[model samples]
Target: MSLRLNCDLGESFGSWKMGLDEAVMPHIDQANIACGFHAGDPLVMQKTLTLAKQNNVTVGAHPGYPDLVGFGRRSIKASAAEIKAMLQYQIAAMDGMAASQGLTLEYVKPHGAMYNDMMANAEVRSAIMQGIAEYHRPLVLMLQSTPQAEEHLAEAEQAGISLWFEIFADRCYDDDGKLLARTKPGAVHSKEKMLAQVKQLQEQGTVTTVSGHTLNLRADTLCVHGDNMDGVNAIQEIRELIS
Candidate 1:
């Protein structure tokens, strides 16, 4: 499949605000919207859905652990059953809200620590896959594209769910095909480097890792973040490049 651009949105709380969703929504093809577990409320989600619909962007559920203070970046320990329940709860919430707006969630992409844990822990990954499979309607599961693409695909097949392998356009990857920790230096790329990476992915279908290794990633979609003005501007540039 051709690579598509997606962004996380609807992260604003009642009084506080987060992300330049209004500015970034136009540039993206898919919107991974927060489902209130981490950073969004019903009203904010409704507004985001309306914005996405206005832009003709596809919607995906962005579910995370209930960690508002840490923005869902902090890991939470829970059983596989608990993880499955959490996934379903969030998906149901988003699905109902989207239905209200005459919209439908096209996929599920876990946020923050839940995302990382799903990538690293087999148990967590299985639970998430199972949850998606058991949902009332079919929904694709969007996750990082790693060297273990075949393995992940097999797991998805076993769970009876489709997969969309995603790549980060502005983040550094380790040799293991995992994103570098945010605390680490150079975990995020500057605008020039970010554009360069996207160019390489377009031209060569590979990325250079932090350890100076060439890693081939099967990218179905490219993920962009618009947490600031710079990020919003960068998304516009990236949209042009990818288009």
Candidate 2:
């Protein structure tokens, strides 16, 4: 059972810093780096990719709404066309940044509200997938590992997009396998419990939700937020435990 660990990184904007990326980079297998619109600047993007290269961590574009003030966590209404354009633009910038350093983006993960919206709405998910298929062919799309993905897999496959199923190391899930909203109780798993969940996944290829429902979920990767410094410490612990 080779479960890869991923982290959302490079979220700093301008002079304001948002994460402990430097401290977290060396511990993970893949990095979902932020593009400028959400919570990064050109310099920050470049530096983040450079660090990824240095650490030999795989890189992916993390695009979100153009809400810098909200760290791309705030939802904004946009047409399907508009959603496609935003994803394409951000992914292109990340790819270019990677290329400049003789690297390449390996996947795409929509951030914040964009991610949540896509998870809940097949229309939005299909639109976003169609958009990525046009601009970033060949890069895997990292999305939640839910039954919804199976329902929409055909459309994405038709568009020539590959999907990467992801489970969170620091979050809780509903019976449906959709993540519980962050505002809800038991949404964020504690380090001990998070690692236990990881262990369960490694050993059983599934996890028990907060509702005590067993979900048969598989993953190409597991995620830990770079800003989750406390979670960062557990990365080493997870590796040691799993090893």
Which candidate's TM-score is highest? 1
Clashing pairs in 1: none
**Best candidate, lDDT:** 1
lDDT of 2 by residue, 26-83 (tens): 8888999999888989999999999999999999999999998888889898899999
Q: Cα lDDT of all candidates, in order?
A: 0.93, 0.86
lDDT of 2: 0.86
* Candidate 2 weakest lDDT stretch, 10 residues: 147-156
RMSD score of candidate 2 (Å): 1.4
What TM-score, to 2 decimals, does candidate 2 have? Answer: 0.95
Candidate 1, residue 77: lDDT: 99
